[model samples]
Target: MTQSPAPLPPPKQRRHLREAASLTQAQVAERMGVTGETVHAWESGRTTPRGRRREAYAKLLASLTKADMVTNTQEAAPPPQVTVCLNKKPNPRRAVSAPTPAPITPTPITPAPITSAPITSTTRTPATRTPASTSAPVAVAAHGPVPASETEPAPLTPLTPAQAFDALYAFCAPALVRQTYLLSGRRELARESVEQAFQLAWQRWPEVAVDRDPAGWVRATAYEYALSPWHRFRPRYRHPEPPPADASDRALLDVLLTLPAPYRRTLLLYDGVGLDLPETAAETEASTPAAANRLLNAREAVAARLPELANPTALHRRLAELASAERLRAAEPTTVRAGSERRARFWTRAAVAFTVAIIGATALTVRTAPTRYEPPVPPGETVQGIPPRSAPGTLSDAELKLRAKLRSGILHGPQRLIPLAE
Candidate 1:
């Protein structure tokens, strides 16, 4: 008798299902509200789905494969009617029936026919689980494949950008928040930026997943979005940072926001994206020299605006800092205005009024007081850095003319930028 081959992986089934449904790892997490790593573990069979999720995953696959079958049927035979045998959920009934096989061959039950449109990967999620590396159970045929089992189970699946970023943020939101807070001068905008950036990342999971630096992509995107002028017009809400899910969460996003758009854009490409000037130029659609000039000018302008922060001499400045989710999501829509700035404005106006009162008082005091002068000396002797009149005890004609000319300046209104002498 031919020995039965090892149970095969649903490789073709999975590939087709993935294509038909366009499920990315990020979308998988978004669908299930789980981490990206969890989906990786599921595809690798490190963990298994339970309860409603197990049914969701199985149903998604079944429906997707069936849809593909309908499309391919234009030139080929239709898929044979499939009797989907669902696995039993954990329960006491299963314990009672655990050892009992059906008494004999029983009639198969017909599952309901499904006709939903293909769910976009951005919206729907795949079954996700954590890797059970230490005690992984062997996967029996999941009703997906029963025909081929030649090679080792096709190497575990890959994650899409959306999925990877979802995983990264799931693991590192807190730190991202803290970093974002430090990067952004204000907290509310940073928190929203992080959240919005991750949401966008999920929408484009495939391309993002394969990207060399998805975290960088997300960060760059977040900063750019926060820097948009429209963001300012909209009333900002608050969400504090939480415990970070990963190490890369430590990037400060607020600093980029503090700078002008042109400078921030330059910094995002050259620094945040880790591109050299030429690559930055290409990515930003500018010439290399122009990119380089922008970066330099931006840096100079940013430094000038924040002298204390620009200090290269301050070696203790951390290149990275850790943050957590609790903090990222903590700030509410309120509590952003600086107390000092508000108070300073009020005090400044008060001080101007006070100065005007003092000016009036001084004018009254001057008018009420009498003026006096001292006796003049001989012409040869100097009095207050000036020649005295020629006659003793009397002012000379030339001395009187000079003193009057000097007093004319203070008696007049302010002079023009061009010299009065001119």
Candidate 2:
């Protein structure tokens, strides 16, 4: 009795056949008149093709694989050669002409035969050769590849100002806020710091979008602002309830809080935020070596608090787990409403700052101004106007009459006096 062939696993068979035929899942689906997801489902072992669909799929796979094999074979084969006979036929349009005799006409033009010079060989090295014409020397770069700094960076992703802001906020806000929260140990401060950073980013999106590390820029800015002393006096500082901690976490938090701020930030950034020592150092305003030392010292301190964490491997593993949990918890999506509120708050703060500056300038101007001065004079005394210098002469009767008439006019009249009220 003939034995039946063992059936192949669906996913393996599908993947092998598609890859062998150099086809994508989508391409296979297109041939089968099914959605790409359906093909993915079959190949991922999530669902199986059945009945008529299964038969049709098998047939399609067989045909495509066969066609691919035939195409490859044809491409790999060499071209055929064709031979030509030189003496096959001459055209009847014109037969080759016989050479005519160049007879006695050349007798007068005969001359002595010229002597031939001996041939000689000389070797030339290509490197030392100079061009026949004057030319500038060509410089060859010794370096294998141009350094990244020497190359112009590609343009930033083509995004409208609004789209850039939205995308950056959506991608980085949660992570930034989370990192800030780990630093400040307060949700409200974290939220405020992240919002402020994003506000600045939105206002300067052109610069920020082209930055090599825009998210890093945002995080560093948020961190600096969160640590500012002015936040102590904010009336609206509402601290949200801390995330629930198990016994181990409570112990970890106790140890973390007891450490110095620098050590704590280094450890958090290294493990919690998955930043390397150089990056953590830059963010915390410390040198890389200093940051490394701080991390080691902080780890030892934590080990003292929890003896079981003394082992480096165990410590790293536990920290990694904690960081994973923190990320998962902090992954809440930032909404449009939140962004709008942040923008409004930013403008409000800006206006307040501008008004304060204006008021300060005005006060300073008033304070520094020179006081007006009037020459001291006795209460009852008046300084008379200097009399005009004139040539000494006796005036005629007509001139004297004119002067007297001018003195009687309104401009030259005596001033009226009014009595003060008792």
Candidate 3:
């Protein structure tokens, strides 16, 4: 008879759910599709929660990032301290001036139960890896300890709150934008994705603020927002596609965009960022096998555009000859919604208010017209004619710039956009 593989080991201890969800064990258990006893058992590591139930469990964990619920605990058996290489990316659109956190370099996985969980740190390793070159601000506990035969964890310094936010911004900003860019191929639209994630983090910064790994919080937030396209979650986005400079690139992007978000992210994270099925599974919170399927589905969908990844381009060409059926579709124009219009108005009003302030400053200067003092003329223009000048204002150029900036500040400023505008 066939022998079954061993069960997966226990991850370090973790609270079944955090308080941010404001959910109790009973509520979590209900969402987890198990008995309260089962929830306790899983958290306690008495027995493993399996199958579709486990998927549901992961989904709940991913979504539970609602309010900032900060909990630090170990599961029955801690997961191996594997340093995940962060996917480092630069946003082509926005200017991010923050310092990047160091790269994560945990000990390689080993197959033994070890004491003292290797805490996460923020330090930089060489840019040996792509995308995930940055370090994690927090060392996250694995769902279970890795095999003892694997790598060892190396110690590194942890980042400060400012560093953490910087790292968080850099880490998630590019990844989220890239995924959105690949799908929408529009910078403004991609920015919408980034802004949504950012607003959520700001709203719940207190709880998510302290975690060693803030990128996880932000990334999870981005995914959560992108998960549903309901009106509640939709943000105003009025981005136009950058006519891909190259036809091939344009075709490639079109094909890539056609895939669903789950698959789209999986593709970019793997192909563009260099993550494997298992780790991709963890980041996206899917089972390794299920994540594999999502990746496959995404690839299949893009095969036509990215034929080499899916099928041989030469063979596809030959097949095209045989089928003799060519179908072309007219591209649909992008439409900006009402909320986006409101956002646009907000910026416009701010611009107008700023212009008004500048005009007022000019008027003030005219009102404070310098006393009309006749210049003292040096006697005799026989040599070099020069007229004496009067004293000017006291403020320095730097001080004047500061004054101008401050007086025009929007602090306690009136609302820029009207609540409802067609």
Question: Which tens-of-lDDT digit does each residue in 174-261 have in candidate 3?
Answer: 4455444554555555556556666556545567675434554565565555555562344544334445555655666677657787
User: Clashes in candidate 2: how many?
Assistant: 0
- State, as a TM-score between 0 and 1, how close model 1 is to the true structure: 0.32
Ranking under lDDT, best-scoring first? 2, 3, 1
The Cα RMSD in angstroms, rounded to one decimal, for candidate 2 relative to the true structure is 30.3
In model 2, which runs have C-alpha deviations exceeding 4 angstroms?
1-157, 235-243, 311-313, 323-372, 376-422
Report model 3's TM-score to 2 decimal places: 0.35
Model 2 whole-model lDDT (C-alpha atoms): 0.60
Count of backbone collisions in candidate 3: 42
Which candidate gets the maximum lDDT versus the true structure? Answer: 2
lDDT tens readout by residue for model 2, 1-422: 96433333467566656655556555676787764445655765645676667878767766766775775675466433222235567566864443322111111111111111000011111111121222222222444444646543354445456665665665566556656665665667777777778777766766876665666677778877877768667776554457536678667667876788789778877755545466578778989899999999998999888999877557655654443345322322345435646777888999999999999999999999878976887688655897867897999999999788656653534765343454
Name the runs in model 3 displaced over 4 angstroms.
1-160, 209-213, 226-240, 282-285, 311-422
Full-model lDDT, candidate 3: 0.50
Q: Indicate whether candidate 1 or candidate 3 has the larger TM-score.
A: 3
